[model samples]
Target: MARRRRKSRGRKLILAVAALCLAAVYPLQEQLTDGGGDSRGAGNAAAEDVSAAASDVFRDGSTLEVHFLDVGQGDATLIRCGEAAMLIDAGNNSWGDDVRDYLEYQSIGDLDYVIGTHPDADHIGGLDVVMEAFDCGTVIMPDYEKDTQTYTDVTDVMEEKGYELTLPQVGMVYELGEAAFTIVAPNGEYGDNANDYSVGILLEHGENRFLLTGDAEEDSEADMLDNGIDLSADVLKAAHHGSRTANTEAFLERVNPEYVVISCGEGNSYGHPHAEVLNRLREMGIKVFRTDEEGTVVATSDGAGITFNVPPSESWQAGEPKG
Candidate 1:
């Protein structure tokens, strides 16, 4: 009888251990499926590795579409090229779901790059939520050292998600098929103001080039010009949401973009798209679009020129030029 009792106790102990192990694994498996698992094993087997993800998405010969997402009071831009996608600066934290929904609506299942132009909350705030929701390939940002809580939270989530952080540098190129993106600003030392440290990128496809300037001020813009980087583009994102401090006349002349997109919120405190900046763009005869008025702006290219589409308009007839 004593021997039998001891045997039964040992069996019970083994069963309990097995139960605990199974419980642990169940949660891990669940986490992986719900965007909480090891970043290495969640995506298509081909995207299992970060480097592989970049190479697969950027393989030569891809079409590109640039979407200027409407994240009110902040900035969020999405670039889609073939099977790959990249996001630049998620708006304020409140717009995370909007960003995710927009991605889902467009059938984007994987993200190749997520760039936080700077540490400002309006720029990097929504990134944490995005990191938690997607299996990101890699994250790139300016080399800014700030002590803000938002910055800390963004870094913590990136580290936790096992994302490789890359610092933007001029001459560095990111390729996706036939499309090529070159970093244009934040060329040297990190700046004193976070905005000055904004990461500027230029995307080129055939004769078409698009310049994205992330709230960079006069100082940074001047530095980019002094460095002799090609500032010309067919499309330009107006710096600092069209603030007077940016879009300097000389810088605008160098870019000479045919179209300019400004991202700003309605009734914003800073009075973005200042009168002076608007006049400058008007004087240059550049077509200007604003998120505050147009909702979202999308630019698509087919290896040659680009086309613009606005939300359906009843007042205007088909083929009619937009005001």
Candidate 2:
């Protein structure tokens, strides 16, 4: 596919450098992201995967921006600090070009890191397109595999571009300008369920931190809890698009985020941002933002404080139910 580009919108950027503090690296010459339920497999290992890295050593107080794009029912997040930019996921296959447009709109043609999160189409469907369009440094994804065309598209595009898939190991840290983020989960193994293998991370930009778990369900959450990494954060991206199967009581208690963002499409059939999850978060006194209702959400941090582009919602509104 021919790469597309928009008019040059000069963006001042500073990309990140990942420090893989790997205990065990899974170099997948083959693998995949499409998440729904928990995939059963190898759970976790000894608690030693929680080693400290660059994230613990950096705190220069530079500006960090996180954009949570509203890709209908999928997930995509863009993180930019200084001149460096990273993308977590890209909606569905049909939304690939749209994602590329969004990136171009931000004046970003080079991505330092691209994380597929898991083998879920909603999370990686557009990745192939984005990967083909931009000069991406490192591509990160869970060690999960799938035979779907969506998965093949991503790997095929990487092969075409001569890039390698860098599977994330727990405690891996990468520096982005004045910011840094650490891989926190998939600390062990999970069978075939893509959701359980979701690449979870704890991003720290000075004192402000954000926790994001692709579509990880309860099983993955349990493993993460046992991984021994600090789960507390100023912000969190609810797993499984805020499905009750995820955002477990124990997991939420551990995270204790002041704010939570749910990236599901409006009136999605899956009933994302389910009532059970929303009520739990509100009762816990956490503010919430949902792409279904907010379009796109943006958060800015200056190492000490965080501000959102729009006022957060405390609504108990739930999504459409699956018949």
**Which residue pairs in candidate 1 have backbone atoms (N, alpha carbon, C) closer than 3 angstroms, thus clashing?**
58-176, 58-177, 59-177, 60-177, 61-177, 61-178
The CA lDDT of each predicted structure is 0.70, 0.76
- By TM-score, how accurate is candidate 1? 0.76
Worst 10 residues of 1 by lDDT: 1-10
By summed lDDT, the worst window of 10 consecutive residues in model 2 runs over 12-21
Please provide, for model 1 over 1-323, each residue's C-alpha lDDT reduced to its tens digit, 9 standing for 90 to 100: 11101111111211111111112222222433453211112223222243334334433345577777767668989887777788998787666655665565455687888889998888787777777777898688988868887788778878887888898878789875567799898866644788889999998977899999898988889888987778799999989888888999999999999888888876677778787888888888877767666556666677776665442111111111223
Model 2, span 1-323: residue lDDT tens: 56633222331110100111111112111111111111111122221122123234331237787878777789999998877899999887767776786676555659999999987899998898899989899899988889998899899889999989899989889987788899987877677777989998899998999999999889989988998889899999999999999999999999999889999987788898888999899889987877777556767787777766555664569988655
**Runs in model 1 lying further than 4 Å from the true structure:** 1-62, 311-323
The candidate maximizing lDDT is: 2
TM-score of each: 0.76, 0.81
Whole-model alpha-carbon lDDT for candidate 2: 0.76
- Flag regions of model 2 displaced more than 4 Å: 4-61
